[model samples]
Every structure is written in structure tokens, then in C-alpha cells.
Target: MGRPILGLRSTLKSLTRRDIKSYMSRRYSAESVFITATGNVNHTKLVRALSDSIGKIKRSGKAQVIKAPVATRSVKLVKRDLEQVHLCMGVPVPSMTDRKRFELYLINTMLGSGMSSKLFQEVREKRGLAYSVYSYLNLCKDAGSLVVYAGTSKESFGEVLTVVLNEFEKLATELTIEQLNHTKDQLKGGIVLALETTDARMMKIAKDEIYFGKSMPIKSLIKEIDRVKLEDVRKSIENYLSPDNITLAAIGGGMKKRDLPSVLK
Candidate 1:
């Protein structure tokens, strides 16, 4: 629940059989589990099968409550003689359930979801500063963040960071109505295309239930995306994209923590 959502290998190796048993006993129960199914299936037979199997699991007294995670701002640099420097920089954003959720998605898309996005267009295509650059949102139950990642030569890392930060700062005001509409189309198209498969549909349904308590219809989702105005994206940027809230992690050769870009300082 900290910086690393996945436990470290060292800690995983230290876990004993008793630790696993204790964790399962404390966290695994009918109350804490959710079962979701999609595609062509008989509901009655499904219910019967579930009752005979998963329903038999003993019910715990109550669900284990997870403490919400907090985002921290820090810079870390790891030295290694790798071929390229890799960096992940991000800032805290609203939770998945926030009203500006769609706007956040649009912001992410406008920044770097595709080759046409600002970061890819500026950092890789036009400037040729980096080979790979993209941005994505990592949202959870009560907290979230927008992260930008890039891989480049060690000598180009500073220019790449500067270009990424410049694009980030421009999001508050420079985002145009045309760009917003194009981003909406991109996101909507992707969402519809993803629903073409059973596995994708199943995952979407599960995620919707987990995050919003009910599965939202595709039309409704598209409508939400369409409803996001340029002002909404600007407002989201103002609320969440503060430089002071940024965190940076870079792994490469010869870079020190003190060598972080001035924008991050």
C-alpha cells in the first residue's frame, strides 16, 4: 500500500507458510469476495453452481477495511550502467470516484495515451529526444495519480524531463476545444472496441462494480466522456497537477538524486 503496491522479492521470500495461512484466514471470506460473470450464460445454473462452491466458504464476521494510501513526493535515482535511462514522474490526482474522473482520463489521453498525444509528439516524434514516452493514470479506491514514463539516453534525460514538464504545465490553459473533442473520440472508440471481447467485457464489469457499485452502460460512459468540457480539464489540472506534489524516480548511470530537474526541485 506504499510506493510499491507489490511486495519486494526479499519480503516475499521471507514469508512462511504460517504467514500465508494467517493472511488468508484474516482476509479471505465470502464477505470480502466478489464474483462477476459476463457473456452468454444461464443465470440460474450459474447461481446454483456458485451456491454449491463459493457459497460454501465460511463467512467472516466483517470485511477487512483497507486504509487508504497517501501519495508522497520524493526523488530517487539509481545508478546502473544500462543502455538507456528510464524515468517515471507523477503527481497525485483525485480518487477514481471523483466527479472529474472523465476529465482525468481525457487529460491522460491528451498528454500521452497515443502517438498523437502531446508528449509523444513533442518528446519523441518532433524533438527526437526519447524513444519511448507515455502517460497513464493509476487510480485506486480512494487515491490516484497520473504518471509519465520515458526511456532515453542518459545525456537526453534532462531535456526529456523538461519537455514532459513543459507539456504538463501547459495542460491548465493551452488545451484546445478541438483537442478535447479528439481525445473524447479516442477514448470512446477505445472503450467501445474493448467491449468487443468477452474477457474485456468481464473485466470492465468487475471494475465498474468494484469502483462504482454498479455497472454503467456503455452509452452512459460515452455520455460522461462527451460531457467533459475544456474547462473541466483545466479545473482538474488546477486541482491536481501542482509541481509541489510531484514525485520522480529515475534509473540510469551517473545520475544522482541531487541531479533531478530544476522543475522537480
Candidate 2:
């Protein structure tokens, strides 16, 4: 696959973000074929042309990256229905080239990563507020996101938002070295434990190569984890732990626009 895919380049990479999205929107007009076939796509027309060119490379020159058009989601809740939202709040972080992917990782983990995380212990355990919660660090080819989420009863929606924001402020302010270290250890342990399987190792290597442009050695990766300092975690939290970077995508009971400030106060 690499040999066949080696010479490919994104013609759309040179275009402005708006132009590229517009081109993708027009090309794939109603089809999703182009983006899936080629991992790096730029337009709808390109997708159509690629689909038409499949098994006929000479007829199409070279295969291109898939870039689905930038447009609104196909399915949107009605304004009234939006009262129950699924907030997908996130902040952009270091480029894949920065080699500090782990920093973004720890931030995600310490925030609301699991049943034991800050958000869960405070919001879920103490208050028994939400039905479910999760934290995720979505690292992409060039960029990434750190997000926290929860689904709660509409009646407690305002307080849920409040708890989330207050927790965010605490993470930025009151986080102690011990708290940070525990998070780092958990983060490192999770990765190492995941690598216990051969298939997992192969998949991780493949993903590393695809997203980070190189297959990182497990040993060096572990060493990097061990080297993470208190300052490192703090720096990541300081830059990313902000409400402004959030993009709330809510879908569920009893939240209103007016309740947005449960945390601001």
C-alpha cells in the first residue's frame, strides 16, 4: 500500500481552507466515495473523479487525498430539540510534529478520563449527577483535541455545567504535584497495558506511522513518559484548559442557553 501510495500529494493543501472546503462540497455533491477511498481528499469533485478513476490509474493520473466538503451536518436537531445537547467541547493542541503528543494526552486523562477522574469523582461520585462521562484526546494527522463530556438530567443541567467549569478552574489552579503525578502514571500505565498484546502493538505502530509520520519505538516512548515533569503537565493544562476553546455539542435532557454560565460564576 505504501509503495502504491508513495507519490501522492495533496493539490488542495495549497488552497485556502475556505476554497478547499468549497471544492470538496461541490465535488462529492451527494456522495461520500472520494474521501473514503483516498485517505487525504480535498473536494467532492475529486472524490467523484477518484471513484470514476478507480482501477484506472492511468486514466486519472494519481489518486488523491479525501477531503469531504465543509458544510453543516446532514442531521440537525430542531431549535427546540437542542435543549438536550451533547457538548463536544474541545481545544486544538500541538501539531503532530511537536512530539509533545503525550502532553495533550495527560490533560485529557486527568480531566474526565474515567470513573476515577476529577470530573467523574466530583460530578458523578459526589453529586451522582450525570449518567455517563468521558474524556478523550483525539490526535489527528496534523492536529488534535482534548474533550470532556457528560450526559445529565435536564433539571441538573445548570449544575452539571457549573461542576465541569469549576473543575476546569481547579485543574488550572489547585492541581498539586501529587495529583499531576498520579495522572501521568495512569496515562503511562494505560499505554503500556494496551501494548501488552501483539495486535495492539502493531496497530499502535501503524497508527503512529500514519499520524505522526514515524513509528515510535516502544522503549523510547516509555522513557518519554517517565520523563514528563510537573511543569510539562501544568503547561499543557494552562494552554488548553479554557472555556473559549470549547465547542459544545449537546444532545439530551434539560439544558438551556441561559444555563451556559453555571461555571462562570
TM-score, each model?
0.93, 0.68
* Regions more than 4 Å wrong, model 2: 1-85, 262-265
TM-score of 2: 0.68
Best by TM-score: 1
Give the alpha carbon lDDT tens digit for every residue of 117-141 in model 1.
8999999999998988999998888
Report clashes for each candidate as comma-separated counts.
0, 24
Can you tell me which runs of candidate 1 are displaced by over 4 Å?
A: 3-14, 257-259
TM-score of 1: 0.93
Task: Give a tens-digit lDDT track for model 2, residues 68-120.
Answer: 22222222212345444455555666655566777767667878888888888
